[model samples]
Target: MAIKEGLRPGGRSARVQESIHSAVRELLETHQRSTLTVPQIAARAGVTPSTIYRRWGDLSVLLADVALARMQPDGEPANTGSLRGDVRAWAEQYLDEMSSEPGRNMLRDVQCSQTPGYCVAIIGAQLQAILERYPDQPGPSVDRLINLLAAPTVFRILFSAAALEVEELHRLVDIALGQ
Candidate 1:
């Protein structure tokens, strides 16, 4: 049955890819990225190592896709009619995302990647998009402001497991806005 299902094309391949990505994510949840291997992912996905390799080439590419899926934002940014409001809303969203189980796991996995620059580039590109989306704010350094707001959440999630709340986000906004 599984083999016949695998032989089917189009939608079946998408489902298989999704399953493989999900299996990789679950494995990251249970184990460190350093411990992940193609064999482990294949075993967990109930597919052969050849299948994984045929689909993703190697573990890094598979892990990258899984990490991206895990880190995907829930929705577009909300504008509250003020720079402070928009930045705060964005910060809160980022904080919530960074604090999630899958988000934390993805961060850890990306950190362990041999080419961490790729992850950094992905993050930088997202930040750039946000700035492009909100151009009304007149600030000395928007990038610095974003870094300030995001660094704390990333730090807490990576090192301390601190629970981020709305108040903290508000405080960060106040600091960022110089208000």
Candidate 2:
């Protein structure tokens, strides 16, 4: 049998990772993030500090990894009758979520991690599901929709102090749909 080099889901490694993620999340809820150390997380997770370091390289990256996992949607995007409707619905929902305080923090964490664009891929999957409804007809690419919709929404979320308006989000959907 071939050997697996790293973490694999639903296996022993997954259990360790999940434990670590849980520890980090739990600790963050109870204590200041700045106060947490790798050893504390390792102790809470029932793993060694070296294990966390070997898998995640550092605490910041580990935090980012956990944040990204939390950001995963519970379900696929809602199905609307038309592409425009679906895209708008998804965009509005995305703006609502990403503009929130917790969402913004998660967004920042994943950005600082070794991998960027993990969030983009999550959105792309949902967007692709929406596009599948219009298979016989031509529609905007997922990348195009992301650019015209998610990118701007995330920009306002991360940088702007004010909340993003739904009207502005729909306008982005319109631009993506070329309307």
Candidate 3:
């Protein structure tokens, strides 16, 4: 496995990393990213600050790592055998994820930090995977699809009080596909 910032792939070190990550997630649910401190996270994770420092360097690095980890999908989006079905499934899943408190918190942290485009990149990668399955179909490019799906969804999630309805997602997909 790939080592991350000198962290070994497994063993007690792996457990330590898991604990730290868990602590960060747990803390993030109730704490603002700017207010989180290494000592607080260490205490929550049952490790010393030096352990976190040794693994991730500082609070900013640790938060960035946590944000990136949270942004990852638990698994690949299901292949529904058709581009429309797959895109709709992916969009629904994405909407569900972003509507959660932790997801919003992570998005806020990533947006406010130096890695503002990190979430967009992650979403783009997911869209690219869906697009790769339909090489013969001619429609909007991956970037355009991302804009159609992500841009408005993120805006509504972060700004507007309105909920992202399922019909809206389908309409967006249809529009993107020129259907």
Candidate 4:
């Protein structure tokens, strides 16, 4: 059955991917990223270790995919008309995610790993959403805006014990907007 399923397209592949991703998330809840093994993930996911290796090549690649999947926003960023409002809404969501224990762990693991591009991809998606709203306005570049909005929150998450204050987040948005 397993051999036949592997020979088919789409359906089995999708299920395997979903199962592996779920197993990764479930394991992350209790195990550190560095401690997770392919064999353990395969057991939890109900797939063979070869399936994971064949599909993802290595644990780093699998971890990258898992982090990217988890970082995907629940929905599109809110479009509140004004750029400031839109940015604030997005920033608030980003900060809220960063404040959670799971979010922090995911971010830390992804950032520390060789596959940091997953983190950058999430930020790029947010920047693209913001840019789509204001096609003509003269403002900071997408990269600059991403840096301005993300850097402070990430720094706080990495170094400080304090929660990111709402006012501070607004101020960061304002700074990004060059206000």
Q: Pick the candidate with the highest TM-score.
A: 2
Clashing pairs in 2: none
Better of 2 and 3 by TM-score: 2
Per-residue alpha-carbon lDDT of candidate 4 for residues 1-179, written as tens digits (9 for 90 to 100): 12222334458777888899899989988898789999999999999999999877788777766776677778888999978888899888888988788777766656534444656776878778887889887666777777887877888887899767889889878888889
**Sort by TM-score, best first: what order?**
2, 4, 3, 1
- The candidate 2 region of ten consecutive residues with least summed lDDT is 1-10
List the candidate 1 regions with Cα displacement exceeding 4 Å.
Answer: 1-19, 25-40, 43-47, 50-65, 133-136, 140-142
Ranking by lDDT: 2, 3, 4, 1
The residue-level lDDT of candidate 4 at 8 comes to 49
| lDDT tens per residue, model 2, 1-179 | 00123456577887888899999999988897779999999999999999999888888888888887887789988887888988888888888888876787788777766666677888899999999999986899999998989888888888887767888887878888889
Cα displacement (Å) at residue 50, model 1:
4.3
lDDT of each: 0.68, 0.83, 0.79, 0.78
- Model 3 is weakest, by summed lDDT over 10 consecutive residues, at 1-10
How does residue 26 of candidate 3 score in lDDT? 90
Residue 69 local lDDT, model 2:
84
Error of 1 at 121 (Å): 4.0
Specify the highest-lDDT model's number: 2
Model 4 residue 52 distance off true place after TM-score fit, in angstroms: 3.1
Candidate 4: residue 50 lDDT (0-100): 98
